[model samples]
Target: MVSSSLFNRASKVFPGGVNSPVRYYTPEPIYFARAKGTKLLDEEGKEYLDFSMGFGAVFTGYANSDILDTQMEIFANPVPEGVVNEKEIILGEMINEAVPSMEMMRFTNSGTEATMHAIRLARAFTGRDIIVKMNGGFHGAHDYVLIGAGSGAATFGTPTSPGIPEEIGKTVLVGEFNHRESLEQIFEKHGNNIAAVIVEPIMGNMGVILPEPCFLEFLRDITEAHGALLIFDEVITGFRFRYGAYQDMIGIRPDLTTMGKIIGGGLPVGVFGGREEIMKNISPQGKVYQSGTFSANPYTMATGIATLEYLKKIDYQSTIRLACWIEDKLKPYEDMGLKVNRAYNMFTPFFNQQRVWDYPSAVASDSLKFMTFFRGLLKHGIYLSPGQFETSFVGPAHSPESVEMAAFKMVYTLENEMNESGNA
Candidate 1:
């Protein structure tokens, strides 16, 4: 009744009773009144083990004292806009040190703006128009990325949304994530006019789909061969598995890269950068123009640096160990003929028996049964994203007790499912 009443009031104001389309479920989205380390207290006073983790933005956990203190200090002496802030340079230096491919960078208010700018830079630098994106890759909500979008768009069955003009939509080409021939076919046809191929190196929006062997390497070589820039949208994967960008570990350096989520330290922020020659195309330096009022403001700069500093000292290996342990426990489910795709600290359990490697196969996973699985987790006080296409994250803050409780709940739920199907 608490969340229901809140939804009733919210629906009158916000569309679908939520600000974000992904936040809305069938009955209503539950409201979390407060959050702490690895937990969310709902409007009804029920506490949930938060597996969603702020859509992968929260790496250091909720209400982190270091980040909060940084924010407070910045608030005490407010940051100025329309002028150069020293903290932006400091943050930029830290990011460049971590991800060496970004020789120069620019900040934006959101990943949408970052990707938009990156695409524009690519087009200007290469003197081309058409861009390529993975079929299920979600760069952001902008018109260039919304075509065949995954996550919320895939969950709602509207891969391509309305309102994007045909002229704009036709320029963006879509190809499968792990499928090689699909991209080869696209490049074979539109090689000359293709400005860039933007991809998520490791797909996050479509439930942690991993890139196949040499898939990323192929993108780099092919884009170079066709005189097109390769952009890696590491918005979700920036620091999910390591201290640096995933591309660093994978040994692939993109021409341009867009980063968000963990880099912002839970603030509204985004950054895009690459080789100096390419990034030079962004305004005041080159023809492509980009400017934002809130981009790299002192507040975000301070907290972002603080978070990255904290992450440097933390052990990411701990998260990998914990995630692998959970995967080991869930491995029995695969023996029982179910699919659970995982990569490091991120994973998703599909409700179908078939494998999911691309957008079409991912879409085929049973959404209704996944919702049932979602409700079962909710009953046991585990909160994951409601959409099947979204990835569930595990952070450094998660405790053994929470994992035990969650594991028990998962096995119990699946046992009930098998019984229902007369396979127990």
Candidate 2:
């Protein structure tokens, strides 16, 4: 009732009563009054166990004290001088050390800007016009990166949103994730003109689909042979699994890396970096120009530094162990026709017979059934990402008791769905 009242009033000014498209859904979206650790309290004082983790952005947990303290200090001295600052320099150094591919780096206010600049940098460096992106691999909102986007775009069944000029979409080619032959065919058709092959190394946008054996290695080999830059968009994966980027874990260095979400330390931020030779093209160095007023705000920089420093101290294997425990609980549902795809601290359970590996297979999942399951889970005090295509994140804040509670809630919800369908 409280959420309904707020949604109705907010809808007058904002479309769908929410700032972000993904937050809106049927009935009404719950408005959280406050959140801490792994728990969120709604407007009506009802508490829910959070598994979304702010769409995998709050890796260090909600309202992390260390980050908040640093953020407060920066707020005391709000200086909007020129872009370059001490905090920015330190954060850049931190990023480069974590991701070796980032020989040099630049910061942006959001993931969309970082991705947009990455594409432009690739084009400038390679002197090519075409950009190849994996099907359902979401980069950002820019015209060049929007083609065949997943996440909310795929959830709404609109891969390429309207208003993006047809000519703009033409320069972007879509390749299948985890399918080597499909990429080979695309290369055969337009390899010469391609500038870069952009991808989410772990494919978080289309749930938690992972690369098959030698799939990443295949990407590295093919892109190198074709003389195209490989851009790993680790916006969701970066800092979520390990203290650094996922590319280092894969052992395949990308030419350029776009990162966001966790690196922001629960603030809004994005960063793109690459080899020094290729990065020199951006303004003040080369012809290609990119600038932003809030590119490296001191607040975001300080918080990010604290977040990464704290993450470095954390034992990532512990979080993964908890994720595995949760997955083990979901394994029983497999016999009842559910498929669970997992990678590190992320997982997605599909209502289909097959394991989802690509965009097409991901879309084949039963959304209606997922929606019912989602609503049921919410009633049981478990909050999940609303869309079936979005991946659920497990954080270090999720205690053993929290994992056990989530497992119980999940099983009970699944049983409810089965009973309602007369399959129990």
lDDT for each candidate structure: 0.85, 0.85
RMSD of every candidate to native, in Å, equals: 3.7, 3.4
Candidate 2: tens digits of C-alpha lDDT, residues 322-364: 8898789988888676788889889888888777788889989
C-alpha-based local distance difference test score of model 2: 0.85
Put down candidate 1 lDDT per residue, 1-424, tens digits, no spaces: 8889999999999988888898888777788899998899998899999889889898789988878898898999887876898999999999999999999999998999999999989998988988888887999999888876323311211237778776676677777788888778788888899999999988888787888899999999999999999999999989778898999998999999999989988898899999999988788988789999889988889989999988888888887777676677777887565577888888888766777777888888877767777877787798887778988888888877787778777888777754432111
List residue ranges in candidate 2 displaced over 4 A.
79-82, 149-159, 418-424
Error of 2 at 249 (Å): 1.0
